[model samples]
Target chain A: MTFLSASLEQSPSTAEEEAYLYLQRGLRLCRYKPGDRLIPEEIAAEIGMSRMPVREAFRRLAAEGLVTLRPNRGCIVAGLTLDEIYETFEIRSVLEGLAVRLAVPKMDADAFLDLERLLDRMERAGQTGSSDWVVRHQEFHALIYTLSGRPNLIRKINALHVVIEPYMRFWFDYVDKPLSAREEHERLIRAFAQGDALHADQIMQEHILGTAPLLAEFASPVRR
Target chain B: MTFLSASLEQSPSTAEEEAYLYLQRGLRLCRYKPGDRLIPEEIAAEIGMSRMPVREAFRRLAAEGLVTLRPNRGCIVAGLTLDEIYETFEIRSVLEGLAVRLAVPKMDADAFLDLERLLDRMERAGQTGSSDWVVRHQEFHALIYTLSGRPNLIRKINALHVVIEPYMRFWFDYVDKPLSAREEHERLIRAFAQGDALHADQIMQEHILGTAPLLAEFASPVRR
Candidate 1:
């Protein structure tokens, strides 16, 4: 399958932005595994771009903690250790809980409908064992943050999510039962519909933390 | 004043680590104000180092959101806006609250004594109107995190503190009354002594959030 979508390729911007997005997509899709060296020339060639833009993308990704740049060595994808995974989810629970509490009181009927539609999409994707399920699940959470009226909080939450995405993918693949995903989403939707902000907050905290143990089991020691 | 202490200068490591600590100290002391362009050669000359180490320091600082590295141009100190100030404190409250709850149950008698000593130092610094008050105050909070036995959480809390340090300096300067600082510490200490983890958590959350309004009033629009 092609890494770059036609729409992303056709968008107007500097080469750096395109390259950054290209590399980000590849990382998200696990096209580049953790500790894998990223050679700028090869990436630039694959995307029909120059090495300069790809090099710039490497620096940007490094800044975001997605990659590490060694002095004499090239850039490599960053890995999360067991402790780091627990740390990431611990923060995620609090931040996402705050988002739910802030969003529920302000959510209107249309917002509820949007969440329902996204939940439906996630359910279908899960039943079919489609990779797009994770994408839809992220959108569902992102929608809740967008309704909260705090763009800064959303940015911070998204950053934490990006760092943990690969491990999350690992968890999804190794775990046989995908049944909990749908049930949890349904419970959250019900809490939102009832206008129970506190309950929704608690559910979010538990939902995020519930996966911690399973993910921790799969985490390997991070390579320095 | 000399930017680097004798110990820091004499310590063994790569040029990059030394340069990073030097720049971090400068930023913390407000030697480099927000929006000030950082010239690698000038910093290198001041520290008796080369431009390469200074350049690496810039990249590390940028990763921490402490500086902005503009393409084609040089790096500049990053400024916080009103919204960012509020957001930082919001997250700080939650994380610090978590720290207090986690630390209080595990704190030993020696830990309590250390906290008391730090509080005493802070009180003295406040009464004398010494600039070292913030340093002591940060140490007091850091001690609490250290006692919690969670190094990862401490690192995350410290990262948030670094981003907000300059604005905190602004807040400390513009507000003359330091009485609240002492009183708040006393209350937190009392809660810890009583072994009331939940109460300590609440006090921490309130203490951090209480300063948000005053700091928000002093924040300027971030320079693009």
Candidate 2:
């Protein structure tokens, strides 16, 4: 509610945070389309602020892979080429698989069962088949990351998450079948519960990257 | 030269890029130390610009991992932890390993000679033992990314490059000798000439994580 603000009136810390908030909201709502011109004055006006903080927000968003900085050309709203998307997911699949591998030795029975609860919640969320549910499903996987105890790895994984946001949005736009994604999650949960790191790694890797691009052609020049 | 300006002029693009340049310079000089405060007026004043453009630059820098957004606190210069350094180098080592592996099969004799020339230049640079030469030596390694022929991978690799800057500076500060790093470069160039992917990867992996607070007793806190 707070950090993920819909408006920019009063962010807790500084003008920069407020600036970042407006842009984050814009990105989440698909208001700032891929390859859109991101004018500071426009964003600042939208958030009922000046250009100061919004400029700051743009910086973090760039780091998050939502914006690009080029010479001659300034910042543009960033989109993943199909190649970048594939690369991002492939790298993430291995890293998450690594996380899952690390988590196995540390996972207790309760943690296994807790994940089941998340799966069920995701299933329930899927009944509405809302974008909200997809986000919740993403969070469920993030919980698995928490068990791994590697903040360093987690940061890189988060970067990948940001990189693919738009394509994920497009995927949900066309795909009416929620059951497939949910099914994938259920299968992944089962693999994790068995404490089979190799299988779990392979399963999760496929679950994250294999299916994501197949839902649509991410690398097509038209998307660029 | 235009990008080097600290002042934000009346023009929008000029102002915005000037802002970016300010932070970039600040980062280069370590003026914005990890955890340093980022006040809009302060930045604007120092850059000889209005708060608006400086705000814009802050956003860009935050995205680049040069600054941290503190919710209500505004922007603070971002800091790199030792753990982050390790994880970053680990990922870079893997990606670069992948890069050179891809490049190795396709490396023409001319390219092999090019790699040798780069190494020789670096060795000559290393013999002079100037920090500036060492920095350029680092750039010689970076040119390998472009040879990989994957723009997306290069961007990711470059992102990794920015993330490691502060820590690498710390590393240069600590190491008593520069010759060993240069010698490793020579060995690496030879490995690349032989099309030795495994050996190149091995040397690179060591070359990167070599900064691992390997000597446990030497793991002192990074004093501000």
Candidate 3:
């Protein structure tokens, strides 16, 4: 989407964009693990494109901090240390908190209704134990943040979400606990409903920061 | 700098890297203003390079949000709205505050001395009304934040600083005020010397956030 649209000189139909989107989705979905080598030739064959576009996509992902390009070893999935991951959560907490605070003044009754509806869908997806739950959950938060009217701040926050999405997916798929964020979502919505910007900001920060330790504890064993 | 080192596929001597450094320094130093058109051919001629590498450098800068690329209008320096500029300062406030908090535990007596020395250089530069003051001012803050041991966080903060740097330069050049941040910075160092992380963080956040209104007030007339 608009994240790196500036880098796409051609239309969305271009091979490089296609490769980028594909790899980005794979990474977000946890299909690509940290430290995994990305073979351009193999991806090219799978996508029915040449190696050049795939390599170009690698370079793009490298710039985005999604992958690392070693001098002689080619591109590898970018790995974050536990502390780095914690720092990322810390960064996101303040940023998303800022987003919530900014979004409060802009929120209308219709916006509140929209958030509730998204929360309903997210809860339903969670009850069903469908992987659709994660998508809806992300959509729910993103909807609120998008109203902040700060594109640059939102962009940085979204990039942070992308970096940790795989860990989130890992936690959901591997952990045995039931999805229990419905209550947290309800409280956040209530905060917004009350038009308590500071309260919402604080809730948003703690909600995000609270997850870092849990994710780190659960995902450490499998992180390569 | 490590800001966009991942985008440089070749050695530092490459034409593209040279163009990038040239443009970046120009942007950072206020030689390039908001809404300025970047003509690759003209820049190439000026730098004794082909237009291709200059264009490549433009693409990189576009990705970094320093410039915007239009369909037919080529590249122009990115111009932020007053609100966006305010938000940028807000984001920097929280981030740099976090950096100070994290850096506190890691800070040593030697680090405090280093910060004082940089402050001395910055104050002397300010007293002389030397433009070198801005560089040393940046260096002073950067040194404190770098000790946070969070490269990702520091990089994001640095990028924000770059975006607002020209405005800072404009304020210093066009406004009629003595460079009077010496006392404020001395207080920050005092906070650090006392090992007061929370106080330091609060001071850092306020220090950064306080700049937005002044910069917006001063630069509004000059902005296109």
Show how many residue pairs clash in every candidate, following the order shown: 0, 17, 0
lDDT of 3 by residue, A1-224 (tens): 22333343344566766898889888887778888999999999988999877876775577678898765578889877788789899999888888999899899999888999888887676543356776677778878888888888877876777787777667877765444467778888998888999899889888888878888887685476
**Candidate 1 residue-wise lDDT, A1-224, digit = tens:** 12112333566366766888888778876778888999989999988988877776776688677888886588899877777788788878878887888899999999999999988887777542366776677678878987877766776677776777777666667666545667788889899989899799889988888878877775442222
- Global CA lDDT computed for model 1: 0.76
Candidate 2 wrongly placed segments (more than 4 Å): A1-19, A38-47, A50-63, A67-76, A94-98, A101-105, A116-136, A176-207, A215-224, B1-13, B38-47, B71-75, B120-136, B177-203, B214-221
Q: Between prediction 1 and prediction 3, which has the larger TM-score?
A: 3
- Candidates sorted by lDDT, best first: 3, 1, 2
CA RMSD for every model? Answer: 4.9, 5.7, 4.2
Kept native contacts, as fractions per model, are 0.30, 0.60, 0.37
Q: Write the per-residue lDDT of candidate 3 for residues B98-127, one digit (tens) a residue.
A: 899888889998998899898888866645
Kindly list the per-residue Cα lDDT of model 2 for residues B117-219, writing each as its tens digit: 7666666664433675665565566566667676666666766665555555555566555445766777777787788976886787677657455421132
For model 3, state the Cα shift of residue A131 in Å: 2.8
Tens digits of per-residue lDDT, candidate 2, A4-62, equal: 12223554466656666657666755677778889878877876788756655666787
DockQ of each: 0.33, 0.38, 0.44
Q: Which docking band does candidate 1 fall into?
A: acceptable
* Least well predicted 10-residue stretch by lDDT in candidate 3 chain A: A1-10
Error of 3 at B57 (Å): 3.0
What's the true lDDT of residue A223 in model 2? 58
In lDDT terms, which candidate is top? 3
